[model samples]
Target: MPAAPTAAWSLAEWLAWQEQLHPKSIELGLERVRSVALRLGLLPARAVTLTIAGTNGKGSSSTLAASIYREAGYRTGLYTSPHLQRYNERVAIDGVQASDADLCHAFLAIEQARGATPLTYFEFGTLAALWLFREADVRVQVLEVGLGGRLDAVNIVDADAALITNIGLDHTDWLGDDRESIGREKAGVLRQGCPAVLVERHPPESVLAVAEDLQVPLLRLGRDYDFSPRDAAWRWQGPSGALDELPLPALPGAMQLQNASGVLALVETLRGKLPVTPAAIAAALRSLQLPGRLQRVGACLLDVGHNAEAAEVLAEHLRSLRPAGRVLLVLGMLADKPVEAFARLLQPLVSRAFLGGLPGARGLDAPVLQARLRSLGMETEACRDIPEALRRALAQAAPEDLVVVTGSFVTVAAALDVLHE
Candidate 1:
């Protein structure tokens, strides 16, 4: 049962209360949220909304989209999930997190409107973000779907344009087990006749089928729009036109170029309505930042690549780096993840591995992870916590060697906390 508040509750209080509101952390269907949204009159919005859904790259895509819109002089509202540190990080207006007071106010409004209805923590936050966006009078809103697009809370509002960055096997317990099923679930964000960008060069048939069924003008990678690397920079060509000599993405890795291409395709799709300048696009590309996806902090390289597809992308980045010394991996993952497959993908690159305990009910403890890795014929060291694992990795690391903290967002968040401390 949800806790009752007396007098005034702080943002933290509201968040804590919200956690206990629902029995399950994630209930994917949207009826409860849709009803609440209807009651609050949040449907049929003002802003030109861009909803992004993917197994990976959703954060990068959303960040790039918001920054591009901001550089174009539009007031942008960006809502992303699983904040690394602060809850404020989830809701950003013009690149600034919403203030505590503002979040509290939004929560209060939602509480008043919801009545007897219950909402998950994510659902509550989604509603609050939408409310905040509306109140801020944002010209454009970029929403990252928390889970599968079809029934995700963020899917309540129909998008003016949408992007499904890539369909990979993830959240299989909730979404189906195959790429085709996952692709169809993500393609739910596509609105009829809306310009939808499919970033995957080889997208699942179900995704394409959805786009075709809904009459969506789908711009696909290696099909409708494409990018090519030129040393440090890249070039993109799409239906609207071509952009040459574009700067390499501020975010590192080969995967980001693909993400940037999708973002550009989306920008081109909404060009008639938004009309961003080339200069703004260039500036945004060079300046955009998302915290956890392959962020380099001092000597440590942190990534939140937990699943097989993300692990493969991380492998690509590692192989590209080809460090002189060695790549020491400090890893922590949730219990439900495909640990064996994830560990096996990077086995060739990782010289040694440090497994750490993760918190929460779904956490896979260090011993289990260490056993899993060792069983795969990799050298493994088990540690009590993220800090301990990182400390061990750093102690053993040579100056030329790299220490990668990865596996899950929780893992990266913990590593970051220790790094900051």
Candidate 2:
């Protein structure tokens, strides 16, 4: 085995070392991670745990849940994956990103405990977050599953409540090919007798079967819980009661309502232990901020929507906005994603596309994306990278036009760096 990182090592050095520590970057199984957690005594976290799993809205839903708990005066921890800018974004306490010194300490602890066992980059991060959360003495922890829930590193903790925020066809290679198989994998987060919330009105049978077989107290949207528009505000009705005149979520898009409703249901299940008031819910919705989800900066909008489902939602949101001028797109995607299908979904709304090359082995090149868009009969320009794409798109866009930056998280991160500069 390679030498472990020392206490003096920086967070960036530790992260770089971890990326090459394991044989496979993404070997999805619990045995290795669970064993490490046992050694670290991170199992059975003292805090109330809410594990969120889904292809699309896991980030938004997890953020919403954690914000509500924090607003209710709890020291909350949130762990999410594929961060846009920095590694620190993965583990947050009370809405603040974990500090480099804290993360380095956590990494050292895990390094000393793991002996000869090898851990993937993601596994190391997950264990580190759990250790930090435990040390912080958080009252609640919201864990967003890194991949399919069954064996995702975050699933090591049997959560008090599990929320599946509408599964779709994503990570098909690792999870499965179809929605049924994907749903089954996501459903693995649900524990027996624990409450599970489903945001999808008509979830796949596989998800429902797992809940039924486990005898999970399921709260499903449109059945057990639902949301409706009330003027500029909205109302959420769940098994417990109704929360009326709630402010629309600060997160844009109609899909946020679906995510908010499921979060409300999950919050209701934990009321006995957490006890979040209606005011906290309203406050959280009005103030919560999630980066790169239709996030607007002047005339440019940035979203990390890489798949067909996300594309559909983005298209819907764009239509609702009704931009006075054409919608210009800057897109970069991983090689594994369904670029053609994703592009087709937004083809009608997009007047022109500026394609760019993403980094890493999985990132698709700009020329490849150009060919895909051309096949769809859409006008396209291929840029060397996302920053160039954003620049060219912005330079060409009229004042009334909306410039959209999207595809993978990496794409949006690059655009954000340029915008900040």
Candidate 3:
């Protein structure tokens, strides 16, 4: 077995070491993680737990729920994956990321407990987050599934409530080929008798079947709960109650209302354990801010949306904005994503496409993306990296025009680093 990480190691060093400990980056199964979690006493989480799983809106939904709980005077612990900026962003307490010392301590504990068992990077992070939450004695915990729900490391914790925000064709290689098959995998987060909130307007039959088989009380958007635009605001009505004149979520995009509505539903389901007032709900909506989800830095908008479904939503938002000059796109994506479909959906809205090569083994090259966009009759330029692509796009963009940086988290992170610099 590889030598155990030293207690003196920094958070960065521990993370780097953990990455190399596992042979495969992603091995979707709960046995190994569950064993380690059991040893750490993380099962049957002491806090009221909410687990969110979906293709597009998991980050937004989980953040909204955690914000609401925080507003309600609860000590909230939130854990999300693939952070845009730092690894610490993956674990938070009351909207504050865990400190380096805190994360390192948790890692040490897990290392000692695991002995010789190997754990994936995500598995290690999940265990660390749970350990920190437990140690902090948090009142509520919001966990976002990293990938598919069933086998995802976060699933080890049976949440008090589960929220599945719309399913789409993403990670098809691991999840499934079609929406139906993927829906089933996402629905695995739901436990029997536990209430589940589904934001999908037209949910697949497989999802419904899982809820039925599990005897889960499913609250679906448009049917069991929904929201509508008021004159200047919006209104959300769910099984528990309705909140009117609700300020729109601070997060951009019309689809956020759907995510917020589902978060409210999840909040309502856990009302018995962690009661939240309508005031807290409204306050949370107005205050929540997630980076890289249609985030605007100066005239450039950065969104970490890579799937075709997300691209479609992005197209609508761009149309609604209707910049006087033109929309320029700086995009980079992983090789496994549906690059052609994503480009095709956004082609009409985009005036010019600047394709940037992403880093790492899974990253697609800029030349490849340029070729795909050119074949679709879209004007394109290829750049060596996202920062280069952003710089070129910004130079070409007029004062009234908007430059959008999107495709993947890594893509947006690169743009953000340069923009902030």
Candidate 4:
């Protein structure tokens, strides 16, 4: 589109300027990005790339994998999307966020290289991250797909191993309205003859068909590999072998075992290239942390679970925690999410729910979400914003009771901001 707003701008100015270039915020396709990437040599050449795509566990799985790689002494480059609080959280090299100066430099280079090619904000950020990772000469690059696997900007690079965490009915408008259609779109990340890991216990036939058609050596959960919880820890059995007495993930959720299992399978798939010791795996599991996914901040527990599947996971986590008192919920959801389904899953666990309005196109109003919960026969309170909702939830909860701020990432982010303040 038009030239960048100004020259020699800061990261904030550059990000705001980039957002203006694309007509739509999220335009999914690779042609425009691929052309610019080819010009800038942004594709991964030397590094081992692992592309992760899913509805819920993608963040945790990617974090586990990247942390293990980092623990193994590899220069790890990770690129995730839709940062909760800071844009800088999206790209990191060797466990450090890319500096604002570094991102600005990369943005300036892409701005010059793209010419008339109108790149979406995500496309530009993806290219910049790849370029930064390449320039840094990182040995292991983990890219999380921003949306559907096929058309997501990160999928432009042919990953050495593709990890599909699990499929759910989120992003139906862009990806299809059902799990099978979503699975087919996610299965696009699988490459012929390359190793692909599907950690979903019951994967869609479309994904299996795509893997078969592409001749992808698929390692599926339950069939190819599985994990079972022991008293305290879990045991992972894969094609490579079984690893017993593994430490539970430190991410504070029972569902993390499922995510960690996929991570372990991917580790096994890439072990030939980047071998990690059992010690490293154990260490990574014990040390791994991801914010806004069942994260605990002071007295408030925060989860960025916007869909029904994620709500199921959150419910499981809350049950495992076994809070002795009431579990008050401060919730805010996007307009497109299955608010009723999510509410149904979590309502039983929640003693009382406070609804808050999130801002932007996808956000649902607080009163609207409160009415939805009330319709579900749940106790509800409506607040103007996440801060107010969190305040009310905390006020309602006793010291023994748990206060959870959840629903969408924006909700968690808002809670975090208010908590930090």
Candidate 5:
């Protein structure tokens, strides 16, 4: 199914135009985007772009890296997928989202460039980001892959640096189930000799083999660099490098430590050329924030972790925060995911689970999902939607108690609109 159109030529016109071009939200093969890119001349001929791909933490890692570079005083551009509150959030320069006028220029450019040929919504946005960044004369561009990297649209532009954070089971229908298969697919972003940074404690051998075959500069965590705790702070050391004591990332959770390390390794690899100072790194992590990733909203907390691996990360963070009273969860997820795994992750941490149907054809029906909550063995209520779920949860809780809304980004955003009100 296609993403339903919701833009004016204003936002709507461009959205409707692009939606008609592509048959699917994701066409895994890169050939169409590559051809259009050549015609549109969208490919970067000469620019230092750091492309990142991973199942989780891609946005956080990109934010941290961009923030550090910006703090160090470089003109940096960041591109991430699936914006929460606004489409503008996907493209940013120095932490500011692109304005609607900028988005208009990009949409028009892509429309003219494509001629009669169609591009996916993601493809259109990728071209727009490149166009906007080039026009703005950005010093660095960090492009996060939207889906599996092997044939994702972003692969059209080769990278000066490529970082693959971690491999996990996701988009299983497109990629394979096994870790090694997924790792090999992700290794697609690596350029022949460009530096590729990885944080896998045990990276799949397939990824290592691909890197070896390509002679890519392999920077592995334990072998090339390592991060470990040092008293109250953390210490990171790279091959031919060491970053002294650093504070924990303000992003919260133990998973962020690994992500922070990856950010450091990438910056460290480009040190003199990128020239980021330790003070800049400290400031970025201390101030870096991404919406709806274990994020606090008024007295309620919201996160966009639906899959089991992400759920595990959310669980660990909740354990640390340990909100003052009994925990309450307002949960919604796609029907295809392991709903059981996510339910288990939250059931242990919260006192009651408020299930709801997310707003999409793929969303799991709330009442249908309720049966899965039985294993949770906790009090559960099925709400009509995210807003209703939030109303129910908030009415039952005191200001200090936990009211968590988790599952998908759509769920978080819908609830966030109410949380802000």
Candidate 6:
């Protein structure tokens, strides 16, 4: 729901337009966007799309797939949601963003195409990403679900290969209250007679049930594809074949190895159609980069682990490092999430807190965060925003101390911006 004059606005101004269009920030279900998409002729791209859905690993899977395909010399497009800093990061081709002019053109195109239908912020953005990908004629497009997969705007395209990374109780309010219910919601993107990869180490039965009922060729981890680490290297085995020797992924987390493994399984699943060479696979594995996943700056660590599930992986990585001094956490989170679980996971790992406000409407107030810290018996400092929080951490931290920014993407994003500067 862009402004009436979106055609006259810049990308930022148009984004502002979209913000006002939807009364609610996030509307879960795909009916409205799907109908608009059908009217706009977007369903055919469904035949060529590989939609990846999950709470934590959707971004990682989409990027990994896009990189592998592009390194193999295929023109590839990658789309992920809730960009950290810039809006353009949500859409890319061959690792570069869709230009501002192109995005503006897309905004105009979607505005024209929507007619009387109202689209959510994510829905409009999804349509724009699809529009850009179709116009550019990329060989393959890797699309990440904005929310639960089944009725998301991205589901309008029937996925050629749908990868459900894992099910978690995220967005429980909209999808359902448990893993089984959430898993069923995520299972919505699977298309019949196509390859569907289940990357979960332990998948819920709901996901498996949907796959069986849909009649898609299911490739399950440990069953259809498997991999392991040995002597600073790893091995992969898939339905098409095996890679006995491979470089460990450069993505900077233990979780990413399994993610890359799934991508290889998918490539193998579509071998003849996609045709990725060993060298390309190796190159993509070596060069793939994600900024905020366990990144380090001098005396500071930053990650975008916003949920308890993600925090577990972050916690393991932190434990391995065993920083000399206690961790000082700079925290912020969205109001809707389970703040208690996120805080609980990091409490033992954290020694104190520098509570701060994140940069959006959904962010938790610094005072509320400070209260949480006090309840845990942790020392607390307050700051206006991320830069001030980091400045405080830098001054207060011993050279041996580790400052971790957690709680949400908004928190990590602010820390990442300062670290880069």
Which is superior by lDDT, 2 or 6? Answer: 2
TM-score of each: 0.98, 0.98, 0.98, 0.97, 0.95, 0.95
Return whichever of 1 and 4 wins on lDDT: 1
Off by over 4 Å in 4: 1-7
TM-score, candidate number 2: 0.98
Error of 6 at 317 (Å): 0.2
List model 6 lDDT by residue over 71-152, tens digit each: 9888888999889888999999888998888898988888887788888889889988988887888889999998898878
Location of the lowest summed lDDT over 10 successive residues in candidate 2: 1-10
Best by lDDT: 2
Candidate 2 structure quality by residue, lDDT tens digits, 128-220: 999999999999999999999998999999999999987788899999999999999999999999999999989999999999999999998
Q: Write the per-residue lDDT of candidate 3 for residues 249-313, one digit (tens) a residue.
A: 98999999888988988888888888899899889999979999989899998899999999999
Between candidates 1 and 6, the lDDT winner: 1
Return the clash pairs for model 3, or none: none
Whose TM-score is higher: candidate 1's or candidate 2's?
2
How many pairs of residues collide in model 2? 0
How many collisions per candidate?
Answer: 0, 0, 0, 0, 6, 1
Error of 3 at 274 (Å): 1.5
Clashing pairs in 1: none
Off by over 4 Å in 5: 1-8
Quote the RMSD, in angstroms, for model 2: 1.2
Ranking of candidates on lDDT, top first: 2, 1, 3, 4, 5, 6
lDDT of the structure predicted as candidate 1: 0.92
Q: Lowest summed-lDDT stretch of 10 residues in model 5?
A: 1-10
lDDT for each residue of candidate 1 in 42-132, tens digit (9 for 90 to 100): 8988899999999999999999999999999999999998898899999999999999999988898888899899899999999999999
Please give me the total number of clashing residue pairs in predicted model 5. Answer: 6
Clash pairs (backbone) in predicted model 5: 7-11, 7-12, 8-11, 8-12, 8-13, 9-13
